[model samples]
Target: MTKKFYTVSARYWSTLDSVEIVQDGEKSAKFNASVITAPAEYSFHCQLVGTDDLYPAKLIPNDDEAEKWDVLISSFQIQGFNIENNQFSYASDCTSFFTPGIWMGLVTSIILLWILTYGIHMIMQLTTNSRFDDPKGPALSVPQTE
Candidate 1:
């Protein structure tokens, strides 16, 4: 009987989110999240890539080594917020509140304020026009009859 061995290679990449790896196998590795923060006006995504193959032989043999080789891949997305030492740590979901929500709220408030001011101005203008006469226009005159 011949002893067979296999090798595995894994890589993970993310734009704004974090990744946590959990393995219950003989070979395992740990990785850190990317440093890029989420965008203020849009949502972002994360990606993972993993590859595995049999060792020694460049191509996997169908004879017996194929049956011995096994690959397991697992991934998880972490969410929520944490604050420590006066520093803030935000996950993908948590960061969204600061980015999209804040800007949306700001824009909505500004639009509402403009609409309210315009409505008030229109009302005041109507009242003034009804109460006062135009000073620059000619007055009404009647011809005197003999």
Candidate 2:
């Protein structure tokens, strides 16, 4: 099998004091403020698959390659709160149900329903016999044919 390469680049405005790479619940590599300031890049290879219908695909590190992606921040503290997770949050790329096409369809259906209702009302009005109408003269009776 061929190897797949993935690149991740991030730029943050927050002051990063230090970064730590933890493996097996222990710190494997630690970089201080000076190292974090320098321009650098890190690459890792992992398996990714479709998460669900909503989500497309995501990186899944196996047991043998999990450690390569386990980079934890040692000094990532904000107001005495520790934010050490290094994984990016998953975001779905799927289209929602209420899209433009669906909206157009809904609007069309509403218009058609309104037109149908109006047509029915007009037909009823046209076919209805008004009891308030005055008779022009005496009613004429048809001659019986035996």
Candidate 3:
């Protein structure tokens, strides 16, 4: 079957606030007892651009009550095809502490810090305040002192 070409896009907005969900209702409290967090809100738009089936795109809705926010896809592509549509075929529910960029940045920072530290250390070690005297040759006598 010839795949249909569709375009879909979504924009997300989020804020950090202290909110907690109690048995009665949500209240102002530290999220996970860690820090204040804000709620997330997003909207989606679907449209058809042209006839191309390079890849099929699927957008899944989040079903989590705690994080009452829609799944926002920053960018997705398949077979070099940009996916933008509301074709539900897959779902993912997970939280991540670090992405590839985050990890790369962290590693790069550490490397830079190390390079700076090593450079400073080398400079400090190489510095000399006084010159070494000739030990092999006879020492010169002072005019007044012995």
Candidate 4:
């Protein structure tokens, strides 16, 4: 399997601080922040912390993977907050096989469908005393009795 890395960043302002400013209809302060998250080996955990303006206060790379870093900075403005100067780093495992249980289920479903279609064909043949023929082929002839 191949692994891919992605970094997510955003700029925003929070209303937590300066309640008076918010009460007076003043815009919240803007700041820039980023977080780096990677898939855990034999475990999956992503921590996101919320601050007055930035979310996921800090980003820490997983120790097992290389120190490849990807930086993503938010360009759009959200409410009264502005984000800038953000960096992100992460890693993922790209090699893994589908679980046996899922594969078995899929195979079982296909087999069941084949069996059902075959059973229907057999029933039609028995009832009509004729082989199931394709509509695209020549039509069958009916015997005439005196």
Candidate 5:
């Protein structure tokens, strides 16, 4: 089977406020549920490009009745901070706090590599002058000798 690629994949986190079951005149929904976190949740929902079988219909908590509703603590991601009910925070530059030496070592190694490459190039030019020709340029005037 071939795997399809998604152009966008995003994660959302929200605490559901409530769930409810609404009964019409005759028909009823067994697996009916509404999702509620906060107003920010909708903005994240708006970014979703595709849909499962049950979408385009907003899932909201049934704020009227209480007995007919069931809350499922499934690990589904939602959009925005549910800070009215929970806390999710983010901060930048965490790597500097944890591993400063790793970044510094990477920079030092890159500089050392450039110096070694230049030295090797000069050594090769001096050793392989079998044709006995002195190329004219500022490079030749550098006077590199043992």
Candidate 6:
């Protein structure tokens, strides 16, 4: 049952990075990936590190078929994380993943707001405050007339 899916136009960051593998512009996989295992040829084992849905699927190969199947299963793993460096370098391709303009717009808006706020803060500091006259005391405190 080959259901056609359009992948997002993205490429892997590198051999070390992870990416979202969506089906037909959605993160939802078409196949029921109910199994997981290591490659049969080698003693290499695979542990499913992540999934979008809580429907977790983790497996280990006990037989040859299960091991061969692991190759197919590996393809389903989305979102690679670097445990060593503690960083996230996201994958590029995903022309199939949903291109919701709203999501993109929201991200853009947040960035713009940050830039604007930062500019305002700098401008206010430059105009109102000096090294000697900077307000170090509480604003609500009444001056004790000595």
How close to the true structure is residue 54 of candidate 1, measured as C-alpha lDDT?
25
Candidate 1, RMSD to the unseen true structure: 15.9
Best by lDDT, which number? 5
- Candidate 3 is scored at a TM of 0.27
Comparing 5 and 6 on TM-score, the stronger one = 5
Per-residue lDDT over 82-145 for candidate 5, one digit per residue giving the tens place of the 0 to 100 score? 3344643331111124356887898899999999999999888775443443677344433457
Candidate lDDT values, in order: 0.39, 0.38, 0.36, 0.36, 0.40, 0.38
lDDT of 1 at 94: 20
Error of 4 at 3 (Å): 13
TM-score (all chains, Cα) for each model: 0.29, 0.27, 0.27, 0.26, 0.26, 0.22
Of 1 and 4, the candidate ranking higher by TM-score: 1
Q: Evaluated with TM-score, which candidate comes out highest?
A: 1
Question: What does the lDDT come to for candidate 1?
Answer: 0.39
Model 5 weakest lDDT span, ten residues long: 43-52
Give the alpha carbon lDDT tens digit for every residue of 1-146 in model 1: 11122233132222423233335654333322344333332222223222233211112223342334443323323222232555334333322346677899999999999999999999887733223445797764544561
Off by over 4 Å in 1: 1-25, 34-102, 127-146
- Tens digits of per-residue lDDT, candidate 3, 1-146, equal 01232343233222222233344565222232111111122222223211132212222222245344322223321111223475432322122358689999999999999999999999988866344557898785545542
Off by over 4 Å in 2: 1-93, 127-146
Q: Per-residue CA lDDT of candidate 2, range 1-146, in tens?
A: 11223344343222225434466896354433321221112221122222122322222332343434533222221211222366422222223459789999999999999999999999887754333434896665545661
| Candidate closer to the true structure by TM-score (higher is better), 1 or 6 | 1
Candidate 5 Cα lDDT to native: 0.40
| Tens digit per residue, CA lDDT, model 4, 24-114 | 3643333223322223222112233323224323223332221243222232122222213442223222223565788999999999999
User: For residues 69-126, what per-residue lDDT tens digits would candidate 6 score against the true structure?
Assistant: 3223443333232323453233333133445787899899999999999999998877
